[model samples]
Target chain A: MRRERRRVERADDVGPYRLLRLERDGLDAGEPGQFFMLEAPGRLLPRPLSVCLATPAELAFLIDPVGPGTRPLAALAPGDAIHLLGPLGRGFRLDVERPLLVGGGIGIAPLPYLSARLGGPPALLGFRTAGHAEAAALLPGAEVVIDPVLVTDALPSGHDVLACGPEPMLRALTAIYPDAQLAWEAPMACGYGACYGCAVELDGRLQRLCIEGPVVAARRVTGASTMRAGR
Target chain B: MIPVLNASGCLDALTAPDVARTLDAYVTKTVTPLPREGNPPPRIAETDVGMLNSIGLANPGIDAFLGEHLPRLAGLGIPIWVSAGGFSAADYAHVCSLLDTRAEVDTIELNLSCPNVDAPEEDALAIVAAARAATVKPLYAKLSPALPNLPGTAAAVAAAGADGLTLVNTLRGLALDPATLRPRLAAGIGGLSGPALRPVALAAVYACARAVDLPIVGVGGVACGRDALELVAAGASAVAVGTALFADPGVPGRIRAELAVLRGRVPDPGV
Candidate 1:
């Protein structure tokens, strides 16, 4: 929960997304599906970015620059100071012997970390086009699906599913694989439990996504209308 | 010395107990009579200079908060200021009365200015009066910055037996998405807080400090020690850090330390 100023080692453009490698010292090896709140200078709120890669000296985040909050983060250059809070929120639970990773669009942010932890699991990734499919390379043995078809339709049967993506995609996947562990994203103010801004409806109650989960059991999610992705 | 506290709903004491322990008093999120799911998602938006949120007074309700969180919060060894909100005067009274019996509770903050709710300015005095009759504990009416006559409202609440005022809650604001041409927040509008609202809060504290003789808890947009000092110089007896907690959880302690440094450097008027 300490805020630290980390230097950006690199900000590389990968199709429609940007990958930022930050030089953070003494950071814990983040668990799969965990995220950090990145605050650029001059933005009122920080963007919640999942840890795409974590090492002792550096942390990587895959970002989609859709709104004012994230656009600046994507435009970072080397040696820029970016403020960060966390390695926060519960990550994906990897308990099954056979794990399948599924991600849609930038929702694939946490899969690479999960795959690395599982020693490279099979992944099914979805994107708007082949151009946006470059992220699939991060996941070993991943099959990419272009638009007009959802990645959920390609879910391999009989494997423990770990998924993250847009709300509609998550909803569709949860219906088919209710036992999956989902990394949910919502427009958050504080990427912690304080603001209760990133609340999701689960079991007929509202839960803060920042603490209760960025990763949660699909069955507990109940539905998708309560979820709103980054603006 | 008056202790610096966090305004209700701004900090989750349970999640960050270490940070909460640093504050002189811990203010819980506003609890209503019954459980609240709060507003829909897209409840928060970032404006150019501040943040907007329509959390809609979300809480586990009084019973759950008192039962589940109060014991743990009491263990933190900081004075607990339970913030109570409701739809009607009686609701405020009921919640306040229940908290009055708890030995762990040090003060009750009557949240009279939640923009997300249909809380009327006219009800401020009535709500305070009702809660005043129900509890012997000290009461602080958290005021709204949007009120037309803030001094008059502050005077009314004070006359109704409120011990002090938590000057200036968030001002209502809206942010529209440029791409979709839709409201950024699902709630359509939310209360604005952060550096943007600091001046408004200072103005309210200054006027109210002159209008009423009660202690004032300056809130809204306090980010640093300088901001807190400005509010105190404007006549606030204490200040609470809010939206800044998002950027840095250690802000409260940092501001406290900075304030001490600022105070030590001040030359005595006698000299």
Candidate 2:
């Protein structure tokens, strides 16, 4: 949970997103779904990003320039310096049989790392267009879907499901795979539990997503309103 | 010497004990009489200038905090200040009385103005007076910068027996969604905190410093050592880091070192 100034190694294009690779700088990449708070230059608040990939040398984030905060993050270049505090929050539980990875759009950020941890298990991804689906290349042999064909439409029974996506997709997946480990989203001021800004309705109570989970049992979440809490 | 503290409801000490350890004093989140679920989600919005939060004072209630959180916080080796919140004067007084006996509690910060909740009809002076009567512990009234007559309120609160003051809670703000053009926060309006708040905090601290002789703990958008110095220059005896701790947990130590560089001596908390 140390905040360090890390230099950007490179920024690679992955479909509509930017894969900003940062010098590892000895920072622990906690768990697959655990996130880092990246300080965007000139922005008042740092944006919370999930670990997209963590190699021995570098940690990478898939940035979706959805709003004001993320635009500068996606626009990073080689040699750029940024402050990052992480690997915060709870991530996917690794104990499972017949592991399956599920992601949608930018939610695919954690899959590459999670897959590596889970022995490169089967993955199903959904995106709005082929350009966006190009991120699936990060996962070597995952199944991809283009909406109006949702990733949920192709879920295979008997596999322990772990998923991340927009509210609609996560809710639908929760209905089918109640015990699935679903990664949730919320606008977070602090990646740690301090701010309580990342709270979302879970099990009929408002719980800080950054603390209780960025990852949780799907059945525990009742409403996913903070999904609109921005990127 | 400017002591550094954390704004109430901003840093949860138990979750980030290392971060809390850097502060001169660790202020707990506003403990209310009853447990709070807080407002619905979409509780935070980040604008170009700062961040807006409508967390609505959510907590496990004072009893739970005293039982579960206080002991651990006391063990952290930093001086503790409890931020007390409630709907009525009695609520404030009752909570204050409970902390009056806790040796771990070095101060009681009466949260008179949290923009996230419906403002109480009872004014800051009444709240201060009520809490003042209930507790032997030092009371520092945390006021809002948005108060129409801040200096006057500060004077009144001081006269009513407040030992000190925490100048400037977050100012009221609203952030609209760019595409939808609607309120971004579910609560519609929230308390704004960050660099954007430094000037407003300075003004409040400056004005309150002139109005009351008591020590003031300045808070709002204190991101760096320069900001803390500016607040001190504006008559604040201490500064509390709020939003910046979220972005950088190491901020307190950095600010302290920077302050030492600027002033040539480490500021004592004087707790």
Candidate 3:
């Protein structure tokens, strides 16, 4: 609930994304699917980053430097002080037996932790091309799938699915697997539930992704186009 | 004494009950007569000193709020100040009449200036007078900083039976994306709140405090105890924490502590 100024321990480029490992004292070993709002100097709002990896002393994030909020994070160097507020949001419900983790592109950010929590379940990682697929190497033993085919096509039946990626992929996956739990991203003003800036329509009501979940049941979600547009 | 409360829509007490408990009082987001879906994507964008938002007052209608949210918010144990907003004076009176019967409701805050909505001219006196006739509970008018004559407006609302005033609301602003050169917010324009609006808030409080004898709840861009003290020095009876809540959920409690230390250090002026 408190924001802390943390120092970046390492910053490296992984294919099209930048991975930054931060050294934070009193850092919680956050649950898989939880995220932190990372703030750099000069930026107005902190960017929400899913916990790619978390340990007792360090936390890592895989950031796509596509927008203004995220582009500045790529320039962070070791010893740079970055503000963090987190381990926020309700993480994945890890109560099912034989759970399968599926990730597309940078949506793969939270899967490495989800996989570790599941005792390393076989994951299906999808990307636009082989170059972008290189980031899948961070996931140890994920089954890599390239463009023209979706990871959803290869989804096995009867296994509990957990997914995060672009809206189309999530929308497509949800149609096939209604019970799957999904991690959603919106243009969140407050990574906490205070402001309804990141609200998503679900079952005829608006739900805040920061509070109810960045991770939510796929069947409850509506208006995939709105989510895709990052409203 | 009500130390500090969060302005309406700034903190969602239902989701973060623990954080809600830390505040002196809880202010629920603006609730209208009918449910609103709010604006489209890119509803919020960060500015150089503050943030811009076009949330469109997205909230469940009064029926659901009273049935679902009010009970849960009352359970938080903090005093609940229900913020009511609508397109007409009748709408304000309608909602106030309903809340008047609820024992759990402590006060009513009339949101008169939601920049995103298209409504007829804001008649603060008419709204306060209508709500005053509907509810006996204390009523406060949350006014827009953009009002051309704040002091006269404050006097009119007070005479209309408003018990207090919330100094200022967010100022309308626009941001453009560098690459696309298009508006950054989907709503094209959004209300600005943060450190940027502090001076404007202070001026409003100073002017309104001298013009009217009613209590004023100062709110704009208070992120710390020092900021709260500044409003107090400007004649605000109490301050409401807004944009700062996003950065620090524990800010209200922290500001309370800081205010105590600040007061202790101030030399006593001869009475």
Candidate 4:
């Protein structure tokens, strides 16, 4: 709800991604799966990052250096300052009795926080390689998978699924877990619904993903698909 | 004092009411006669200097606006400017007539130059005249800066009964993915806004202000107070924050504060 320039406490490499830790500075870490718009230095547009971990004093983001927007975020050194605005968008409804966290690649960014909110629920995380799988360290007790083997392949039954990852994985998960909670991503300009830049066709309607979701129920999405990755 | 408004489509007041309260008047996104799904995704792209978007005028249409959005916005206690878009002159006039009775609508801005849609070839004069005849509310024509005869169009629209002008909608541009070498936006091209648009917008405002006597709301890449001051110096009666609102919703208040500080340093030119 506020925009502040929080100083970077650390930017450590975890496989091919960066674990960016910033001083919390009065910003609320809202519900798990909610995202912040991180204004990457030197980039015209800010990139949306879900909170990877939130200690009382610091908020951490797991970033993959995918392209122009995220490379600078991954390159930030300690003592650098970055502007961020968020705790925006709908997050997971943590009312489930038997919660199961599912994530793929960088989508694991939101799972750690979500797990904490769900009182350390079981997790299944899938990455592309052994190096990429190193990020699994953040989710202490979660099972890990690499590409050629999807996390959906190992999905356990009868648990309320909370998921985030690439579009393909989400689509497959939604097909199986009709009541699952999924975090989706689209290229966004304004993380609040103003710009309509994040509009995705859901159930034959163009819904602004920023408002209806960074997290949404699986049944609400019919054919919506996104090429961009991350939560 | 000059008003600091948000350019149409830049700020959704319902979602960000606090940001809307910072503006002198809140301009709604372009609402058409019918609901539009907008362009396909990959709709936004970040350039080296600014941004490109092909949103295609997505909205809930006027019926939904009056029934749902306007009533909520009325509670915000700020003047509301409705941005009307259409495929034809009648479409513009029809929307204007529909809004004529709504007391909450303080102004109607005819979006005659949305680069994302296939706009009609009818001149601004025709669209402005149609809207002017349809509604008693003050009408402001939101024109594009990419026009070949911007000054002439401004003068004609003014003579046709436009009360004011919002100078410069985004100019058309394209960004491609370096990996694929294909269009970055699914729509193939998009309207460019942000810091790269400041000069083009200033030129439009400067030229139109000289050609017509109507008050102008200058908008484009206004990110800071200096940017707003420059627009005023170029003859704008008011300034609007556009793409910058995407990154910083607190922009209108910041620019206003900066403008207040800056106005003291510059000698009064009696603009």
Best by DockQ: 2
Q: Could you give candidate 1's per-residue lDDT for residues A55-142 as a string of tens digits?
A: 7777889988887767888889998887898889999887778898899989889988888888888889999988889877777679
Please give the ranking of all candidate structures by lDDT, highest first, separated by commas. 2, 4, 1, 3
lDDT of 2 by residue, B1-271 (tens): 5789999988999889888998899999999999998988788888878889999999999899889989999999999999999999999999998999899999999999999998877989999999999998999999998889999999999999999999889989999988899999999999899988999999999998888899999998998888998899888899999998888889899898898887765454233
Candidate scoring better on lDDT of 3 and 4 = 4
lDDT of 1 by residue, B148-198 (tens): 899999999999999999988899998888778898888898999998899
Worst 10 residues of 1 chain B by lDDT: B262-271
TM-score of chain B of 2: 0.96
What DockQ does each prediction reach against the true complex? 0.71, 0.79, 0.52, 0.70
Least well predicted 10-residue stretch by lDDT in candidate 3 chain B = B262-271
True-structure RMSD for candidate 1: 2.0
Each candidate's lDDT (Cα)? Answer: 0.86, 0.90, 0.85, 0.89
Over 4 Å off in model 1, which ranges? B120-122, B266-271
User: Once superposed on the true structure, which residue ranges of model 2 sit more than 4 Å away at CA?
Assistant: B265-271
Sort the candidates on DockQ, descending order: 2, 1, 4, 3
| DockQ comparison, 2 vs 3, better candidate | 2
Evaluation by TM-score, superior candidate among 3 and 4: 4
Q: Write the per-residue lDDT of candidate 4 for residues B1-271, one digit (tens) a residue.
A: 6799999999889888999999999999999999888898878888987888899998899899889999999999999999999988999999999999999999999998899999877878999999999999999999999889999999999999999999889999999778899998889999999999999999998999889999899998999989988898898999999899998888888898888888899864356
Quote each prediction's TM-score: 0.96, 0.97, 0.91, 0.98
DockQ of 3: 0.52
Worst 10 residues of 4 chain B by lDDT: B262-271
Off by over 4 Å in 4: A229-231
State, as a TM-score between 0 and 1, how close model 1 is to the true structure: 0.96
